[model samples]
Target: MPYSYEPHYFEDLDVGQTFESAGRTVTETDFAMHSMFTGDWTELHTNKEYSEDGPFGARIAQGPMTFILSTGLFQRTGIVERTVVAFLGMNYMDIPNPVFIGDTVSADFEVTEKRDLDSRDDAGLVVIDSEMTNQDGESVFAGDMKFLFKLKSDAE
Candidate 1:
């Protein structure tokens, strides 16, 4: 049967459609947990004294953590939950601003492109322009992500 609720099938999304996910504070706990999980205990992300003397003037969240949080925020939006078949890849990933503890960040996304898949008629590709921004509107991370989404007919 077709999906009973609204879910973004491949054909349901349109280029230029934009969405912003809810904001979440990046706490010290979040930073620490991410560090432990990834074994990325870089001074910029973990050592306050070291970072205080460094470029950002204080410790900052890990880039990968920031990216993960941004994606999680967007996932919480529930727009593509069950409809997405796979994450194809990412391009042009960049971190232009530091994300510090206590900073509130939100995920923003825009549908930039959509195309059919010749090998698999049941799915299509969707290219999304994604970003994470702090409360001050400085971008924390930005990238273009490609997703394979099941066609509407497959929802049944």
Candidate 2:
């Protein structure tokens, strides 16, 4: 059986098409959960005393946690909800600032490139430039996300 749904096809996306997701505040539970899940309990992220003496002057959220949150934020936009086939890769991922507990965060994305996949009639590729920012509009993370998208023309 085949799936039936309309999706943003390769032809529908433009280089400048942009999307933004709702904000979420980073929480202590988020840090605890992420730490238990990944065993990444570095003092910079978990121990207040250790971090107070560290560079950021406070315990900060893990870098990967911000990445995961950003991805979740982008997914909430429904831009690729049903059209995505696979996550191809990410490029130039950089975390320029720290995400502290209780800080509100949101994700912003723009379609930067799209190309037909000659090998796949039903799908194409899209590259999205993404950034995750805090309440102050300072970026905590930025990167390019590549994904395989089901083309609308081929879904029917």
List lDDT for all candidates, in order.
0.85, 0.86
Cα RMSD for predicted model 2: 4.8
Model 1 residue 109 CA deviation (Å) reads 0.9
- Compute each candidate's TM-score over C-alphas: 0.92, 0.91
Worst 10 residues of 1 by lDDT: 1-10
In model 2, the runs with Cα more than 4 Å from the true position are 1-7
- Report the lDDT tens digits of candidate 2 across residue range 49-112: 9999999999898888888888888787777777899989897799999999999998888989
- For candidate 1, give the lDDT of residue 68: 88
Q: Candidate 1, residues 1-156: lDDT per residue as tens digits?
A: 111235688988899988778788888899889989999998888999999999889998877887788778767767778888898889779999889999998888888999998998889999989888899999999998888999998777
